[model samples]
Target: MERRILFTIMLTSFLTPFAGSALNLALPSLGEAYGASPAALGWVLGSFLLAAIVVLLPFGKLADRYGKRRFFIMGNGIFALTSLLAAFAPNLPLLLAARAAQGIGSAMTFATSMSILTLVIPKERRGWAMGWNVAVVYTGLTLGPVAGGFLNYYYGWPSIFIVLAMIGGTAFLAARRFLQEEWYEDTSPHWDKKGAVLYGGAILLIIYGLSQLNSQPLAPGLLLGGLVLFFLFCRYELRQENPLLPITLLQGNLPFSLSCLAALLNYCGTFAASFLLSLYLQSILGMTSRSAGLILLSQPIIMALLSPLMGKLSDKYAPTKLAALGMAVISAGLAGFALTIHNLALWLMIPMLIITGTGFALFAAPNNNAIMSAVEKKHYGLAASLLSSTRLVGQVLSVALMNLILSLSWDGLSLQETLLQNLQLALLFFALLSGLGVIPAKVRQ
Candidate 1:
């Protein structure tokens, strides 16, 4: 039963990251097919992330109130359906809408999966289970580019969505058949509708505003409005008996809060590295999607191999220290990228990717163990959801930063030159962000 449950959760875990990394390799193909500008391509990616971030916390709370298994099944169903729809989308607008809906499905699965894992697994082996979970996620990342590139090269970008749909359907069936137990913290039927609206609205405005930085007249206004709404959301949550998010978690829990902050900074600094690198390889170096993907596989391969080991080490050592060390390693890797941008031979690029991947594995498993360990069993769903939310939010910001940089740099240079400049600047900025994150990771109680 334990193995089955772990297998099911691990299967579901593969979907989102696979979709993300695979899509990264396919971006250039997508842009050419749709005649999309870099800004529009950013929208294609950002739409899914924004939708996921807005809904994750709410779904997490809902999972706690209702049942994790029920929502997990439903999420897989929604994801499968949306992947099919995305495959058939004729226009960019339809595709974006499908991706947004898929994001909602991703939130449901992500919000509940780790919570369920923590519930069923014994305390002693929890880190090991979590480690394997993180490893499978990297496995997905490892396969996505390779598979997505192969499919895109032979069939078209649409085939990628078709494959995702099949995988989602398989996971849905497996979860429903093999996982019979339902886990719920609160059986109350009450819903926090107002809090949901306010929180969702704030995230939408903020991410949209950031994506439009220097590109639109209303960017500043949208950002200000989002901040105001966020403030209101925080105040309102504090007053509610059944809040959408537990305000006290952030206000009172130092370790949990700092772990979350570290996650946010870590993802913000590293998530877009693939996005930038994909474009650099395909657009700048004129490599095919297949070739670029093969090169990109170097990083996640290391991540997949090392994550479980890191998870085991975290069980014995201080997770906080390990996480802090990971952050420093990540900062070094990002700096390596920036410094070697001018002379990116395969020898240099592959080593840098391996270093970054190792850092990611070190950080992800230990940091996750820290976050889950900080909360009680009842708050597991909420903690999982919040952690996932922070990750998606950071990813959105990372991509938005890249979009802003690309828009700013495209004025007077050739496309290749512009991309090179964007790569250097973005890597430096991300290195600094990762360096800053180490402080929070180190100080977490």
Candidate 2:
């Protein structure tokens, strides 16, 4: 019964992220079909990710106020509706709106998923359970391209959304049966309505500002204005009694904070590769969508197979050491792939992507465990949201930084080659920045 309940919670939690990421691989297809410019395309992607994180804090409180299972089902139901709308969207504006709606549901899903787990999972087994949760969380990213590949190859992009809707519907049904209704226990402050508006505004403005990087000339004046808004957001957040993020948690534990940094670094380097490299394989290497998906399968395939064992090992070994080892391996793989990848054989890219994929998978559970374990149980809900927000920020920055580099040095090369060069540099930077996280890892909890 416990396992059934946990599985239901995870399924509800991860369904949106999985679907969103899976749909990402098809962006170029969507762009071409809908005649979207690069800026519009960025917005298409950015809108979803941006809204998901920004809304998390508010929805988290709502989940606490109402029953988690109630909000969980409601969010998934909305996700299914928005996904269906996205499949039928005829114009770019409609698509953008639908994606934003999807993002809201996604944010709700992410916050409540972790909170429900905290409500149910015993602390002693959380480390191991977190491994499976991590694995499930990424299940979409791993399977998405493969599924997108087959669907886009034969069916069309709409099929992907239909599949996601069906999956979400199934999860909703499962939730109703397996989950119990738990009322809120905390006498925490009233939901921070003002905080939500301020945070959401700041994040959207910042993401919009970054999206303007390649499309519009960088206007220092406008960027300064956005920065001002960002600063005000921080000040606003600090004043809230039950802050969206428990800011105090940052100072409480070294391993927890540092582990988040490590994840940011790993994710910054790892996630960018998939985005940039997909273009490389399809345009530069002249491969089919299916072939690109299959070739890229190396990364997630290795992670899926090896991540569980590495997670188990983390039970015995120091998690910090495990993280460091993984990052070192990733650094080596990225550097080698950057230097060596040229007119390569089909079989070659697999080994390089696989090595780093294994590195990332090995690092994930240990890092999440380190972060969650370092914090008190009482703070798990907000802490979980913050951890995800941290990761999303890193991801957004990576995309913006990679694009800025590409635009600066573009010498009339095709988009594919330019994309590769940009990512090569991004990977190097990701590796260097990841080392910074090690400082906090050395401190014992």
Candidate 3:
């Protein structure tokens, strides 16, 4: 049972985030084949995001009601299927649709991974096990860019999906052969359909509004409409006994809100770095696609190597402090990145990349430990649900905001000049956001 759970968790844990981050490196390739406009490209990026956000909490609840193992196995199969579909897609719209289906699979994988980890690991040892789990999650981010670049270049873009599907399929088969059902049916709670819809609507509106940051400001009506829907969603959640993002999750003595804020700001920096830096290297640095991929490799390389070490540390220390320190270091790294823009050498940038990756690795597991560890055992599902949702909010807005900000200064600039100038300015803001997260981490302390 333990081996079964471990294999499934490790596999799906990486797949969910991998699905999202893989596209970053593949975008240039995808654009060439489909001749996609930025907005159309944005939809390709967003399709998985929107689905993951909408279904994450619901799926978490489903795991609690049914069985985590069940969802893990089934969702892996779904992920495998959708990945194959995505690889074979001939048009942009069809590709986006396939990605959207992939999102459902992603949510299922994430929700189940968290639930299974929480339930399977002992309390005394959970922190360490979860730290390891969290490390694997970050490992996905580290692997995706390198893998995406290589596959797209060698085998074409379709190979990305084909490879991911095979991985997911292997995990599914492993789970089926060895995993056992852990849930004993302790009277499942009432399904909060209305609350679920309300929360989903609110989250979607919020993300949509954020995505528009790359475009013109939201019309007064749309902004007003989103705010109203959000307010109503809050009111509805508080009123319901059974809720998706139960108000109690926030209103209780948990550090939920502050932790979420910290996560958002931290991820904003890294996500911005991931999304923008690739274009910058290719365009401004006058590098080929392969070389650009190599340059961008520094960040994730350090991240993958150091995250497991950071995870072990989280088991002993308060995660908030680690998280804050990590953010501070990342801020410094970004500052270095901005300052050294024109010089841009890989070896020269190694220190900054290492620092940034270390900071993120330090911040990632501990923040997760802080959030999940702080919440009640019974609400593990809710807590895990919220974690995935916050990640959604962070990543979705990060890309959109990148577009919005880059468009401001990059208007009519050559791709090289546009990416260089845009990344410089955006990273400064990204640093500021990360630096500000110290306040929340301090509050948690």
The best candidate by lDDT is 1
Off by over 4 Å in 3: 28-35, 184-189, 213-223, 342-347, 410-422
Error of 1 at 425 (Å): 2.7
TM-score between candidate 3 and the true structure: 0.90
lDDT (C-alpha, whole model) for all candidates: 0.88, 0.71, 0.76
TM-score of model 2 (CA atoms): 0.88
Clashing pairs in 1: none
Q: How well is each residue in 1-445 modelled by candidate 3, as lDDT tens digits?
A: 6656765678778876676677776887888899988778878768888888888988888777777778778888988998899999989999999888888887887776765677787655565666667667777876787777778778988998999999989988987886766552224468778867866776677677777654646633455676788788778778866665666667665476788788888776667786566666666666786676666667776766676677667777777888889889888888878777767665556677778888877788778777777877777776777777778778766776677778765467776676677678888888888888888888888
Per-model TM values vs. the true structure: 0.92, 0.88, 0.90
Model 1 has an lDDT value of 0.88
Instruction: Please give, for residues 313-357, the per-residue lDDT of candidate 1 as tens digits.
Output: 988888888899999999999999889887856567888898899
Predicted candidate 2 versus true structure: per-residue lDDT over 285-403, tens digit per residue: 78986778778777876776676677667777776787777777777777666666564456667778978887777777777667666667566666666667777877887777777
Q: Give the candidate number with the greatest TM-score.
A: 1
**Candidate 1: TM-score?**
0.92
Clashes of each: 0, 0, 1
